[model samples]
Target: MEEKKLNELTNEELLVLKKKSKSTKVINASIIGFCVGIAGYSLFVAGITWPTIFPLLLAVIAYKYLGKNEKAVDAELKSRNLS
Candidate 1:
């Protein structure tokens, strides 16, 4: 589902978002960690190849994409004195 902009969300919705974001943060970190681990393993076993680079790149992209909404929600809440 497409999320409304943080400013457009109601207080209750913002609270819900705050809660959800916390959980999402944990999951996102796990995914990033796993991706990094893969990259590291490939680096050790194969050395400086696409397989090593790809997961590291994927980790960076995943970090940006996954945390995007959570960051916005946090800024919104802090701006509203709700955080």
Candidate 2:
């Protein structure tokens, strides 16, 4: 029973979860990267050079945060165990 959820899983299961989480993280980061690239190009076309960096930086931050699927899995596993 302790080896079911990601967190509670044995090391072997945890490793599998980590690998899957990495894939999801990469996909999310790619999506965010695509959106950011589009937005940057749009800003460049509009000649909005001065503040465009702000949104670009925001997109990067969002990308980083959104790529943390493993952390979510860990939390969920923990919560499931606690119950």
Candidate 3:
């Protein structure tokens, strides 16, 4: 049995991988947002009132921001390798 390497992927396979990675990122972002919002709402209801919504919103924003940073870093590394 042999293991397949990612760089050995065909153009079509690469495209599929790219699309899958994008969708996964979007889905993950959305899930994190929902969890944050819901947890915030719960906290507010529990009388932790003032800070609840702020924390939740910040969590969602931070998660997406970190994801974007990761993608940028990945792109930079790939470009450097190609050059």
Winning model by lDDT: 1
Point out the worst 10-residue segment of candidate 3 by lDDT.
1-10
lDDT of 3: 0.58
Which residue segments of model 1 deviate by more than 4 Å?
1-4
Per residue, candidate 3 scores C-alpha lDDT tens digits across 1-70 of 0113444545565455555667767776776777677776778678565466666776767686646634
Off by over 4 Å in 2: 1-7, 49-58, 71-83
In model 3, where do residues sit more than 4 Å from their true spots? 1-4, 47-83
Q: Which candidate model has the greater lDDT, 2 or 3?
A: 2
Order of candidate numbers by TM-score, starting with the best: 1, 2, 3
Question: What does candidate 2's lDDT look like per residue over 32-69, in tens digits?
Answer: 77767767786878766746566677778877776556
* Candidate 1 least-lDDT 10 residues: 1-10
Question: CA lDDT, every prediction?
Answer: 0.86, 0.64, 0.58
CA shift of 16, model 1, Å: 1.0
**Sort order, lDDT high to low:** 1, 2, 3
